[model samples]
Target: MNRKTLVLPAAAVLLAPLLAACGGAEDGRAIVVGTTDQFIANEDAPAPLDPAFAYDTGTWNILRQTVQTLLHVPRGGGEPVPEAAQSCGFSDKASESYRCKLRSGLTFADGTPVTAEDVKYSIERVLKIKSDNGTAALLAGVDTVEAKGTDEVVFHLKSPDATFPYKLSTPVAGILSKDKYPADKLRDGFDVDGSGPYTMKVEREGEKAARFVFTRNPNYKGDIAPRNEKVELRAFADAGAMGKALESDDIDMMARSLSQKQIRELTETPKERIRVTEVPGLEIRYLGFNTKAPSVKEKAVRQAMAAVVDRGALVNGVYGPTAEPLYSLIPSSITGHATPFYDAYGDSDTARAAKILKDAGVSTPVKVTLNYTTDHYGAETAQEFEALKKQLVASGLFDATTRGAEWSTFRPAQKRGDYAVYGLGWFPDYPDPDNYIAPFLDSDNFLNTPYVNKVVRDQLIPRSRRQADRTAASPVYAQIQKIVAEDVPVLPLWQGKQYVAARDDLTGVEYALNTSSDLLLWELGRGTA
Candidate 1:
């Protein structure tokens, strides 16, 4: 789930034009990172930087790593290990209620001591205001969260949940400094005084505005495998530009999606100078069909689209080996990864797709609109969709029209089923395959599919969520994927291969699906090793 590379000192003298001209070395020490999407300023950054908001990956990486949680993922995969809480377990035998006791001497960035009340407020406040959309869904079964004492917090679950603490460990549930943030809405004020190991110096609205800056938390107390003073994140227009910035040494690292061509260049670069580590990315990319359309609403029409969708061609031509052909809704690394979809639908066959469409009496090509985030993923996304359009039209199956919007408007619009089809990528808020299947596939889910899948809704998702342990949940997840094939809510595209290009001097950084998805910024820069 995590990997480490030799860390280069972020403070290392980077190659500078004038300094190099004089044969003088430059301290290329600042660990500048590059990306295509523009980042909003940190001051204007939305709410608690607390995990409860768990909305965007960019905010999570900045806020999550700086804080300690009651639970966290240890080196290898298993249940979360106690970090802030010295000892924690079920408060009752049924495992419905849970409690945790904090480690002594922990304090916030403001030097005010950390307490169980802070954790209670962090969870309870979000429950009370519910300003943000997804927080309530994440805290679904929670009946109450109470501060039992100065050091202990008790959670009362509406249903028995073995994975409740794991859910709490996600960024959305990140603890805040109860002393600083108001119990109500922070979405407008951008007040993020938390107990994280690092604090934001500046976070702009997006890269086009200015650079995002961070400073080490002076009053922080916690354990980090590798420690560093500060971090800065800068965004660019597309992966092509981000790659160029890295090659030119304008930035020290990058964690955003890269084009297949960019990956080839990053990996093929001499191993001596640049560091490229390919990890199993927890990100899921979807080619979503707007089933709200009368033409696409029919099962046969949806199936035809899936039948003609060439995932292999999409990856090979559009993304290459940097990504793999994904058939199931969940990734193989997940416990509930299912092959049911693949078993039912199989690979693309244009002839079969044509027949399916024809038999359904869809003789006329369906003119559909495809939408995508203009800035989030990368430049190649539009091209990839264009390639898919060519393939679909070459077979005389369907006609496609493409459109774009920035992620802010685009996400809400697609979720509202405003477009005929769209490209969206998901970074799991939590690592469970349930996170994959539960959120996206459920017809009522926020990323709601317009197609109503009775089997998936009534049985599969609920059954998987009810399974006491995750490993026991696979059969239901497999069933969900199979139902997905029959209903064709969205086309499963390619599973991404994550690439992080950081200066060679940075080390001990790894990305996890649930928590921060950070490069473990604490493990970055200015190390003696």
Candidate 2:
């Protein structure tokens, strides 16, 4: 996932512009939602809303509501259930082949018939384009996606993967109209031609999405029944403006972009009209090292940095009670969670960091630049990076500097190895331990870092995936986390707590988010408090 920038809390004047952007509220028929997620478009990522190139949480939030995948993770959360497909499962005991039969009478937003060919084409286009930041790597196990007849789609995997079904549930596998989307290129413009529960009309400001108006899809053929007839998602400059809109009754609900201070204030001083719901989230923030960079190329340099960093202080000072220090790639709630980082570092000792540099014969006052986005994560991200710099500088072994850039430029620069280290936040594509670790460690990792481990990437991950029972893969995952701690390619910082604040009259705020934290706008509607 990409991180946004931090700005000082907004003044009351910031509220006026956001309120004007609401375009006059509906007569209690449409639910106006507020967020600070700005989707950036550039040459590398010309279409931020297209599934083929879209990977960030903000883009995925819009895609999930408008696009239909073959299967979907239920609101309450559990095993995958068919959405576009009438039925789907592994066809063989090896889990190398899977089949799905499409539901009849399905139609895209443009009213084109949905077919198995669309599924095959959609999956193939993602692999064909293979955009650098796209999710093609997630489907790397697939050898071929075949359309057998008009209703049946088959996936032939190169290896056994029990998580194949779960992968299909994500927007990466969202079905698209073959006629609308080019086979070798990403579809441009803000228009969506999906067969999901809701059809969207986007209002754009330059390259970013300003507002999205979603109406129930009359052509939809799925299990979801949208509780609200219409819903409008409005983007803000920062969380402070979003909070103000929520307070002034300009929007019915606020999505997951609230600042740490905003969450505390809302929780501590409960508003009569507003209600806050806190859920355990899979969101995690970490610092990724560019292993090829001169400042941190040596293993000793990375290890020493990790040893000196304090995650506890990061939580207490920056994130407050809204987050907890995370020591492993997988959060504690996951099945194979381990504390390898804690095991190696043992709670930030300056002496240990010094010994690491001394033992390796590295020079003191190591110089490195830390880069973070200026507009994506939250208002406190800058504070978080500054705190990190202070900790590193205080170690007496390193000189650290922090840099900020808007996400549009920051993401591509990180891919080009512009900084020694950069910050990133991950919202899982699916709620699995593999989703947490694979994207960072796999050969085609999301981070363009040069670090690669053959054992973790080629051996352990495959071994773990072959097991149908997730619990059976626990030991293998534990070994993977241990290798991460030893290598220090990425440093786990903290796991976030999800807070969704909405008008008390809203009925489904508690159920609007899936396990991976994707907002399900269909679940929201007006009701008695």
lDDT (C-alpha, whole model) for all candidates = 0.66, 0.85
True-structure lDDT of candidate 1: 0.66
lDDT tens readout by residue for model 2, 1-529: 1111122135523542333234233355689899888865666567887888788888889998899999998856778999999999999999999999999988887788999999999998898988788478788788999998989999999999998899998888999987778899888766777889888888888877789999988889987767767899999999999998988999988986788887887777887788877755788899999898889988889889888889998899998888999999999888899999889987788898889889999998999889999899999999999999999998888899999999989998888888889999999888788888889988667886688899898999999999999999999999999999988999899998887888877766656765577998887767652
TM-score versus the correct structure, for each prediction: 0.86, 0.94
Give the CA lDDT, 0 to 100, for residue 371 in model 1: 82
Give the per-residue lDDT digits (tens) of candidate 1, residues 134-249: 55566666798888778888888876766677777666677777556677766432345666667766545532334556567777655444244556677676777777787788
Top lDDT model:
2
Report lDDT (Cα) of residue 457, candidate 1.
Answer: 66
Candidate 1's TM-score reads 0.86
Runs with alpha carbons beyond 4 Å of true place in candidate 2? 1-28
